[model samples]
Target: MSKSKKSEFRPNDYVVYPAHGVGQIVSIEKQEVVGIELELFVISFEKDKMTLRVPTNKATEIGMRGLSSPDVISKAMTTLKGKAKVKRAMWSRRAQEYEQKINSGDLIAIAEVVRDLHRTDDQREQSYSERQLYEAALERLTREVAAVNGADEVAAAKQVGDVLISRAAAA
Candidate 1:
């Protein structure tokens, strides 16, 4: 039915795809694949210099979703202010878990990665792998926050950093 074929996203709408960060829906197109026609949502990730086409009906199943709501964003900010929870597992195991959280495209989960891996100046330096994961999580979180708040990446990063720093000071 025509109603069933309608898309939830419009061109220029920002969306988050799991395994990727924020992207814009550039267009919707019908393309012939093999013998059948398929409707796809063309999404562009400007920062990553990438574009992806996803079947409209499968988008939700693939975990593609709209930007976080203001309440969700607020909760993520509160999450940042919470104490970090680092498991006693080995570094490699923890690294795998951190990577999974970052790629999951859940803002709150990504915030957990950022918080758990964050190290203050007085703390010992992170291993190369740890630093890489932290930056990745921070970047993902910053991009989403920037998109949601209508601010630039730098300002978003600073806002998140300020929250973490304040948490550190409180502890």
Candidate 2:
């Protein structure tokens, strides 16, 4: 790509930032530092009330990406329907891994977190931190799925919840 070309993201375009969940590209900004000009993509996360500015050249390197394709979302849904994989590691270690996967900006990894932490009827309750992580992953996954499907977050969440509930029932 050439520097003069337009960025892949545009204003009002929803994007996924690795550390954050769903954000919209607000605008492109140009700044001068050390007499060098830099263009930045300003993203806003309404749910988090946070704004992130990423350099145009560093966007991909930092794992900023557009919404997932339908095929990828289908795969993630499939992942949700599959059995959860709870590792034998300690809770602290597993929590760390879960947090890492949530921040990795990968849909399937986030799905795994949701699947593992999900509580079925008559199942044991989750630890506070486990619930926190589960909610975080669920929010992240649901936001993308919502954006892709043009549905509200609650409905999207229900859709995902239905998958989990049915899977647990079958298992």
Provide the clash count, candidate 1: 0
Span of ten consecutive residues with least summed lDDT in model 1? 1-10
- How do all models score by TM-score? 0.95, 0.94
lDDT of 2 by residue, 49-115 (tens): 8898888888887888899998989999999998889999999999999999999999999999999
Q: How many steric overlaps are in each model, in order?
A: 0, 0
lDDT of 1 by residue, 23-112 (tens): 999999999999999999999999999999999988887888999998988899899899989999999899999999998989999999
Give the residue spans of candidate 2 off by over 4 A: 1-6
How much is the lDDT of residue 23 in candidate 1?
98
Model 1 ranges off by over 4 Å: 1-5
Question: Candidate 2: global Cα-lDDT?
Answer: 0.91
